[model samples]
Target: MRKSNLIFIFLMLIIATSCDNEEAVSEQSSTEFSSMQDGLITLKSGAIVEKKGDDFYYQSDMLLSQKQLETLNEHGDFIIEEPDQIENETEIHPVYNIPVEANEDGPAVPRAFGLYPTPYNMWAMVRFVYAPNLTADRKNIIQQALQHWEANTNVRFYNATGQPTVDPVYGFEYPYIEFVNATGNSSAVGRIGGRQKIRIAAWQATSVAIHEIGHAIGLRHEQSRYDRDNSININLSNVHPDNRHNFNKYTSNYFAVGSIDYNSVMMYDSDAFAINPAIPVMTKKSDGSTWNGGNVLSNPDRSWANNIYIPYIARSDTYRELAPVVYKPDNTVMTPSERLALQAQLNNGNPNPPNCCRLPNNF
Candidate 1:
């Protein structure tokens, strides 16, 4: 894969946090592998298995002869097993530049509110850690990513007067994209409208930016190990020997009910490091189909801006039109029923939360 693509993969791994813990458990049981598929063996426990060489045993202990063990040890420890898992963590961040009324203020209402008159002709604001230098290759990559979005959709990437120092008058906002001189690890944030923030890393692959952009436009991981039949190609000889013993330590708790796709851009490169032993296979659709061309808006070589909605605004015609409205209650203390009603309203249709104004000190 190209360096840009690799960087994108790393970014995806960084931004994509596993929702559940992956600490390894004591060896519950062991199973022997009888066959290899795509260079990996599948054990009885559903863990993908691999052998380093003729001398290495699939089990943790040195089950092979002394000479064989020495020969295999030179190569690296064998991978006996690994779990099929998917990450479920969600990214969270505060909406920048939006003002909140004091608790003493009256019911908070949105300052400026309304949807764009048109459905698809929306704009997006991208904030980076640093401005892209004119000569930097990243500038091209960023431009490509944006153009990719503009090509198919009716959206446009607007040039703002200044970086997103404060909240916008309207529309969606993203973190500033900075160009770091050194390579290895870089990150980007994909906030779909205002529902959630998805961070993307730059070190692993260039496509990482594109992948996070996909999330920003509402695409989920394709290969969720949670689903059955997810698989990846592996070279047994290249398996990190010492890391083999602790493989189970990285298994995610989430599962997807689907078949696997090996060629997904969402999948990690074979040589990439697995922070936990049970590295997740690239995510896939529940049915196991690879991502079709149109699925992603931006790619490593291109940039595109489009409008995609989360569940809260599913009913709204234009996602860009929904603004956060704050409400402040006159009475400091809200009755239990009122609190429940407020929560229901927020959950049901209103995107903004109710801001409580002044309250009695005792209450």
Candidate 2:
């Protein structure tokens, strides 16, 4: 399987870089895997599932800091230590970034939370379930967050297709996200396989949901990029002790994409994890400013998202444009059935089947 992807990638990389300027290609394709000369790495296990290439990531765990994932000749332990059962935990950072330390287990190979080598292919039918008790507005907020990601890049987040009569009361039977109530907002870094979650708190602003969806779509905080030390300063003394690690800087080993994305939605804010507002934890060297780019998707953020997943966005996947707009004229959210129907109308035919290895989702 890796061989075929490598072949396809070689052709695609050549075709994508044939433009007069090679810098454009590098700027666009520099993702965790796309930027590498090494082929993408596929994992053999996830939090609980043993399926090959299925895994999840949290923003604060071991996989967050590598300049790039070297070949997985040495597959480390599951980067994030998930709870024995997600249901047993009230809340968790299930998706945060921390340094990868090579222990007695030999050396640590860089790996993203989960493998999402084909995110764009699975974008149209990304399945998710909101906690039933959520109010209409709260559900709308969640849906709005999904649409925000879709609009910025070539992706979609809609109701799970092919409903089953019996669904698991607690979670889905397949790879899915459960947006349940929790103290603060959190989500798995990527497709963790099987049942995963995005816990939303009542007080979290809509932007928080947007940030969490970034994780679900396989993104880590921009400030935590392994190459971030070159762009900003992370002051540990000002940051609260418990959250000090969050400010850890990646080394010179990391690769950078785009003109340093200082205003990405994935960046931590100026006062993040800091006890004193006077002391800026992350000071931007460009102007000695603290990070403040989390409002909306920055140009670099959108570009990297598309580039990382570009392998799946066929120049011919025009049918995706036909996918129903998640937001209505008045900013209301659309349902999955409505989006499907719109897609059918646009194709004047049947939509594509599960091109990716998506599991059954009756539950």
Q: Supply the global lDDT for candidate 1.
A: 0.30
In model 1, state the lDDT of residue 161.
23
> Each prediction's Cα RMSD?
20.3, 16.5
Worst ten-residue run, lDDT, model 2?
46-55
Runs in model 1 lying further than 4 Å from the true structure: 1-135, 150-161, 167-181, 188-208, 212-224, 232-237, 241-258, 269-363
Q: Which stretches of candidate 2 lie over 4 Å from their true place?
A: 1-124, 165-172, 249-256, 308-363
Task: Report the Cα lDDT for residue 329, model 1.
Answer: 17
**How high is the CA lDDT of each candidate model?**
0.30, 0.47
TM-score for all predictions?
0.32, 0.54
Best by TM-score: 2
Model 1, residue 318: what's the lDDT?
25
The weakest ten consecutive residues by lDDT in model 1 span 110-119
Model 2 residue 53 distance off true place after TM-score fit, in angstroms: 27
